[model samples]
Target: MPSLITPVMPPGSLNASAQPTLTIDDLLVRPWLGSDAAAVARVFQEPMIQYWHLRKADSEDEAREWIEQWRLGWESESACHWAVVNADDDRLLGRVSLQSIIMVGGQAEISYWTAPESRGKGVCSRAVARVSSWALNEAGFNRIELSHSTTNIASCRIAEKTGFALEGTRRRALLHADGWHDMHLHARIGEA
Candidate 1:
């Protein structure tokens, strides 16, 4: 594993406003909006999303709570979240987030999900790569980590393609609806 090093910028430099709209190919990764609640509720219905994330919001009101949590995370400087939208029509495709942030240590964990219709199209991978690049190069994060259930081959592929080196596995680290699952840990270091 690469050592966690502090970035040049001081902690708290990355606030909500510091986040920018990032365009990668046809996808637009931007901050989440209150109006996105309905769409978010719909996406959370996906079996795969529900299985991994371990939560579901079937109503707009329930979904708004999720968005509110993301917003609060930004205000607290504890995390950053983005809505993956279609650049042309501004349709929500999925979400990408840098959670578990330790700004003083210049480190964060990456998480993402693709809409059911958007899967197998590399949407998640592209969004993840772009966001991770920005976190390392622009936001000045020294280390980024990704973790997924060991059974999720697709997520493993995304992590590998985005330059995150597989570190090891944490047995029974996450509890899904089925049971406790072992999770693989991956990490990437910023350029020197």
Candidate 2:
């Protein structure tokens, strides 16, 4: 698949041998495009991703179709989905999204999943911290929220590392493959 997350700089005008721009804070969080469908879809097939996002994406054809829908969502301002790319090789590291945006309420939630190979390397924590800071400092958001199944200890750790306060649990909030599962809700509010 072609690159989905490129530096925010003007495309098609980059200099040769340029350092790979990684993300928003040395990371480059940008949208998934047509060519990214295959790779991004493969992520969905991972067992961990399926548990969190709840879809295996089955095949590249399905991923392509999802990308089409994603284009519509982006143009309509319904979502801000981005692929996490490495600063060196520009390889996709993972994906992140600003889901359920509420303009009038000045609120949004962030969700992300790192590639299986990228787990346990502080990638998700760094991404969450950087994005949370942006939500408060750059985006002027009053609140940001994220949730995970109670069994997901790793994600809970990521929340803690990123400064997300444990708000509470919503019993039976998530219906995972194992059946109805409780979810721990977490939130971070900007200084108002």
Candidate 3:
């Protein structure tokens, strides 16, 4: 089947040598590396991460596969995933992704997670804000959407802190291990 999604950036804009590395406060958002598998597996073991993301990498090999999938997403122009790391020590904090991109419509969905050790430090919030700005101003997207299970109060706070306005709720929109969840939608749009 022909692909429906178009590239967010023009051809050659995201070549290997030109991939972006965004710095936000003390965080560095960059492409994932093979050496990050161990840290990725460790983060996946966190209960909150497992609960929301609903996937885990039990071994470094599995984590590598996950990284490979993100790489493929970039190649296919379907998504852009960044490893959120501490700029001071280059420690992996978590991940933030722009997925469900509709280049023709200049829209995409943002998703993110915080590492167990990085929680409560505002890492995710800063990362989201920086990325959202880049998506709007640099990536040329007009609107970015975020959604979280209504039970995820922490995520709701991050969305609000990052300037995403509350949109509405979708009944039974997501199926987690605990069953269907009501999802709250939020969005950030570019200036007129």
Candidate 4:
């Protein structure tokens, strides 16, 4: 798929005061669950997710705990974590979430991971666009933010494609095992 660019949304349609139904390329976006640990986990193991997240996580139990923790955030109303499942097969294809909500400003950050077999196919781009459009038009979110390491070009492409403008870079914001890495910051706001 071609890289995405910033697209102007309808005026007044994308605001923190409204919420739209978001549909991502026939993939149902639903809340994450412990039951989805196994399916959700397959994406975690992908070379891309592993590199971005910077963890190997060799066992299913370990991955389940991680999901459980994310689930806690959901339970506490601290985030919106979701599992992306194929509409036809209902098989979990990956996950996308609005995490670490900055409630004071009516903004939040989004994170997503796609199945290894599903990468380079525009699934991430579609999901981000679909959810971001909903977040702006229906959910009343003011801004959606994203950050990725410099080396992760694929993710950068995703952000750019989804209409998020690259703001700047956070110097050595992430301390990975290999070393510290910079985070490229990107953001998208409602149509003005």
| Clashes (N, CA, C under 3 Å) per candidate | 0, 6, 0, 12
TM-score of each: 0.93, 0.81, 0.91, 0.81
lDDT per residue, candidate 2, 1-192, as tens digits? Answer: 675644322222212222222355556666676888778777887887887766778888898888777555545444456677776666777877667765445466788899888888777888788777866776556788988889989989999999999999999987777698898999998886
Q: Best candidate per TM-score, number?
A: 1
Arranged by lDDT, best first: 1, 3, 4, 2
User: What would the per-residue lDDT of candidate 4 be over residues 55-145, giving only the tens digit for each residue?
Assistant: 7667678878887877666445456666777777778777788887755465789988888887777878888887888777866677999
> Which candidate order results from sorting by TM-score in descending order?
1, 3, 2, 4
| lDDT scores in order | 0.91, 0.72, 0.88, 0.74
Worst 10 residues of 2 by lDDT: 12-21
Regions of candidate 1 where Cα sits further than 4 Å from its true position: 1-9
Error of 2 at 4 (Å): 41
Which model, 1 or 3, shows the larger TM-score? 1
Model 1, C-alpha of 49: deviation from truth (Å): 1.1
Report RMSD for candidate 1: 3.5
lDDT of 3 by residue, 47-166 (tens): 889999878888999999999998777776678899999999989998999999776667889999989989999899999998999989987888999999999999999999999999
Off by over 4 Å in 3: 1-17
